[model samples]
Target: MSIALPQLKSIKIDKFILSLFSAIIIAFLFPTGAGMLHLKQVTEIGIGFIFFFYGLKLSFTEVAQGLKNYKLHVLIQLSTFVLFPLILLGLKSFLIGLIGETFWIGLFFLAALPSTVSSSVVMVSLAKGNVPSAIFNASISGLIGAFVTPLWIGIIVSQSGGMSLGDVFLKLIIQILLPLVIGLLLNKKLGHIAKKNSSKIALYDKTIIVLIVYASFCTSILAHMFDGISFLNFVFLFSAVFCLFWLVIGIIYFISLKLNLSLADRITATFCGTKKSLVHASAMVNIIFANNVSASLFLLPVMLYHITQIVILAIVANRIGKRTLNEAA
Candidate 1:
């Protein structure tokens, strides 16, 4: 079989966008109607690989490099795990009343999830930001999510009667934290091999992300995730989130400029600090939403934002990134 073919290892990460598009097309053409059961398991493995490769790809050096950007990292992490959630919490007083229970809960839970690591780095890179530091911020964000996400859920969901805080806390410590710790500790040896085969490692990454997306979509269909909202309502809600993203990135941009930071740093902080991870969000969904209808629906806002951010960031990253680099030249 050594014949003319597209080299898998040579395929750029960006091409995975087509893989995602293909998955979407396949689902639409078939409605997940036949023999898609295997996809669920495959997605599960993908998810596992996603986290595993995440561990593999990350290194002590990258982590040490992140420590130098503590101010930026803290701001991004706090914005993700704190500022945004608090904004949603404050808005809860009025927003929930207008949106109804399901939509409100979806919005609420969405706010509580951690900043995604790789995609944050990806988006930051697209925006011509400090890629390495963004990676650190994102990696730490996942570690933080192991605690922060569950804690937020526990405190927030108490009024909703979702689940016991302590039990969930214990489970998060065991399931989420343990693996990451093992990976980190083993990084010296495994990291080399993992980094060497980053291409294959990346397949694991995409597989996991796709699985999460598919599973969440499946959950949505199974649980009537789209219930009670019209196309108009989805439009409105998505707009609200879009504006929310704008407001966030906009604020970060101004603050960075005001602080007299370099354009590179500003772009880094803006993109890294502004968004949430859908992958981590999905992983933690069951904790927050449980059997709630909003668990599935919550995904819509993030997905919408993810796509929009990528497109806009790509344009901005390329334009400004070039100008900044040119100034140095």
Candidate 2:
């Protein structure tokens, strides 16, 4: 099950990452255009469609099958939702002073996010891991996050005069939960279409994410929210993100080993547990912080962590795959 080293080396930077940054640059240059065009309303509609496609593509049978491995599921889910958030919360006192309150909140948001669906499964498969469990954990994590992320963020925002927890939940029901439920309800009929055109759907998802990113930055830039952030602050922010990735990876690996998981399950746990979804981040930020002009500021750590996870996990998965092949041979 070894992937070719050459193929691993060929793993280029994700184009979507480029698009994300480009959206930011474009937002900076033409900050007024998004507001002028009323892109906020457009992106909100796009967010609903994103979740609908998510529900459309999801197969309940596969999820049910994955439920048999309760221990594995529990570990991965806890790592994603509980362990990650707790760690950041524990470090909050130190991090806020070092990275600033806004950036720390961004990091907390990153920690609170769900495991990325596509990349988590892909990395597990790449490393010859328990792909089924990865798929299940990745999918379920998002559903869990839809509620949990709001609550987690609610704790912070509630104190700061942001949206009330009740309001956030209401918005989530309308924008995320309802659309997802509709997509699921129609899954029997339209699921094949979603599966058949997954690539197109993924493209659409990224397109919406780009639009959201652009619009968020446009709002922030117009308000000059980033003006106070110096270059040194960015250096500190990136360093914190890099360190945070490894710290979580190390803890997840240790916990997997302690759990005495099979190698395949360990790979699944490590990979899935460590992932954070930018797609969810984009959509949720819009919904959860709808009125916050500083919404884009919260996305900084998320974008940084997204890049960090992809590069680091690709290399880790490649090494593990190579080792597995060597041992088999």
Predicted structure with the largest lDDT when compared to the true one = 2
Worst window of 10 by summed lDDT in candidate 2 = 2-11
On a 0 to 100 scale, what is the lDDT of residue 165 in model 2?
89
> Worst 10-residue stretch by lDDT in candidate 1?
26-35
lDDT by residue (tens digit), candidate 1, 1-329: 56765345632355555655565555445545423676545543444445656676677787778687666776778777887788788787676666655666667666777777666777677657788888788777777777887787678777677678887766555545556667767788789998888777656666666655555555556555555567877776777677778877877777777777766677778877776776676556644454454454666676666666666666666667667678879
lDDT tens digits, residue span 1-329, model 2: 97644564577878999999999999999999897988989988999999999999999987787889998999999999999889998999999999899888888889899999989999899999998888889999999999999999999768888678898899999999999999999999999999999999999999999998899999999899988999999999999999988898899889889989999999999899999999999999987888788899899899999899999899899889989989999
Top-TM-score candidate index: 2
* Predictions in order: lDDT: 0.67, 0.91
Model 2 spans with C-alpha error above 4 angstroms: 1-9
What TM-score, to 2 decimals, does candidate 1 have?
Answer: 0.82
- lDDT of model 2 at residue 313? 92
